[model samples]
Target: MIDDAPGKGRPTRSRKEAEAARKEQMKRPTGRREQMRRERERRNKLRDKQLAALDGRGDAAYLPARDRGPVRALVRDYIDRRRSVAEYMLPILVVILVLSFIPNPTAVTVVFFLWSVTILSTVVDEIFLVIGLKRELKRRFEPGETKGAVTYGVLRSTQLRRTRRPRPTIERGEPLRDRY
Candidate 1:
C-alpha cells in the first residue's frame, strides 16, 4: 500500500508558493510594536543571563564591560584575597557614632580619636593596595590596559567583602593564580 507521492499524501504546492511560505517563516515581525516586543524580550534575556553570571550561576561572557578582562579580574582577586582596613571602616564608623552620643567629654574624645585612626588606616591601606596592584598589573598586562585599575580595585576593597559586586571570586586568603 505505497500511497506516498512526493510530499506524503498532501497535494503539493507550486515552487513559488513554497518559496513564499519559507520567506514568510523567516521574516522579521513587520509591525513596530512587534519588533519592539521582540527586542525587549531579547534584552531582558540578556540582562537576566548577565545577572546570573555575576552571581556565579552562569558563564562570564555576559559580564559588564567594567568587570570584564584579565586586568580587572586580577585586581578583584588581589583585593579579595587579603584583608583591608577599609573593609572594617563602615562598622567602625557605626560604633563610633553610637559612642559619640554619650553625654561625656571622654566619650567624645574617644570617638574623635577612633574616627581619625580609622580614616588614617583606611587611607594607608588603600595606598598600599594601589601600589601592590599597580606592580602586579605591570607584570601581567600592558600599561595601557591597566588604566583605572588601581582606583577600581581600591573602590572594591573599600566595600565590605560580603557586599562586593561580582561577589569576590575567591575566598579570603586564597592564593591567586600566576596568570589571570
Candidate 2:
C-alpha cells in the first residue's frame, strides 16, 4: 500500500501556515538586504557606463601605441636634451654667486633673489610636469626604456613654466621680474 501524501508521504504545511511563514520571512530584514543589492547593482551599472565612455575614444585615440619606434625615439631625444642642462646649471650658479658679492650688493641681492625664485619655481614646475610626461612616456614607450625620461623631464619643465599661473596684478608694462 502506497501512501499518497502530496509531499511524497512526508508531512506537508497547510496553506495558512505556509502563507504565515512566507509573510514572516518577508517581514524580516530582507528589504535592507535587497536595498543594498540594488545599490551595488546601480553602482556597477554606473561604472560600466563610465568605462564605456572612456573606451569610446577622443584623446585616447590620439595617444600613440606603446610599441611605436618613433615615439620611443622622441622620448630618447627629449631625455638627451634635458640631461645637457645639468652641465650648464653649475656654471650658472657659480656666476650668480660671484655677481651677488659685487660692490652693488642691493642690485646683486635683487638679481640673486629673482634668479633663485625663478630656478626654484622652475624646479617645482618641472617635477609636476615630469610626472605627467613620464606617465605619457610610459603609455607610449615599451617597458624598461629610459630614453624618454630626460626629454620628458626637460620639456615638462619648460611646458610647466609656460603654463604657470599669472600673477593677479602687473603695473603698466612692468615685467614679471619686477613684480617678483
Candidate 3:
C-alpha cells in the first residue's frame, strides 16, 4: 500500500525506475556531433575567461602564472607608476627602420645617431628602475622573496603602455600604498 499524506506532492519512484533514470542521466552523449558541440562550447568559454583575465577584467586566479602572486602585483604597480624611455623604444625603432631604407647617406647617419641615443636612454632608464626597485624590495620583503621581480618589472616596462597585458591598474605618478 502506498502512503499518500495530505501535503505530499507526488508519489515516490520505485527502486528499479529510479536507478534506470539515474543511469540514463549519467550516461555520456553517444553521438559524435553532440560530443563536438559540448567540446566546442567548453573551449569557447575557456578562451573568453582567459582573454578577460589578460585584460584585467576577470579573477586574479585566472591570470597567467607569471602575473600571479603578491610580489608580481607589487612589481607591476611599481613599474606602472613611473615613465620609462623603453616605452618609446618600439615606435622609435620602427621610425629608425623606415629611415634606414632611404638612399641618402645623411638619412643613414641620422638613423644611426637616433638608434644610439634611444638605446642609451633606455639602458639608463632601466638601470635606475632596477636600483630603485631593489631598494624598495629590500624595504618591503625578505631577501629571495622578490626573486625574478626585477626582470619582470623590466620586461613590463618595455612594452607600450597601451599594449601592456593586465592593463596598468595605476596611472603615471600614482603613489604606491604602504601595503600590498
TM-scores for all predictions: 0.81, 0.32, 0.78
Candidate 3, residues 4-122: lDDT per residue as tens digits?
A: 64755789999999999999998986899999999999989988888898888887787889998788888988999999999999999999999999999999999999999999999
Candidate 2's TM-score reads 0.32
lDDT of each: 0.89, 0.51, 0.91
Task: Give the Cα-based TM-score of candidate 1 against the true structure.
Answer: 0.81
Cα lDDT, model 2, residue 156: 32
Candidate 1 per-residue C-alpha lDDT over 60-128 given as tens digits, one digit per residue, 9 for 90 to 100: 788888998888889989999999999899899999989989999999999999999999988898888
After superposing candidate 1 on the true structure, give the runs of residues whose Cα lies further than 4 Å from its correct spot.
1-26, 30-36
Supply the global lDDT for candidate 2: 0.51
Q: Write the per-residue lDDT of candidate 2 for residues 1-180, one digit (tens) a residue.
A: 657645556688899999999998887345888888888998897666544433432223323343134443344334333433333455566677777778796867776786786587657756655775577566665667756455544643343222311211223233222110
Tell me which of candidates 1 and 3 scores higher on lDDT: 3
lDDT of 3 at 26: 89
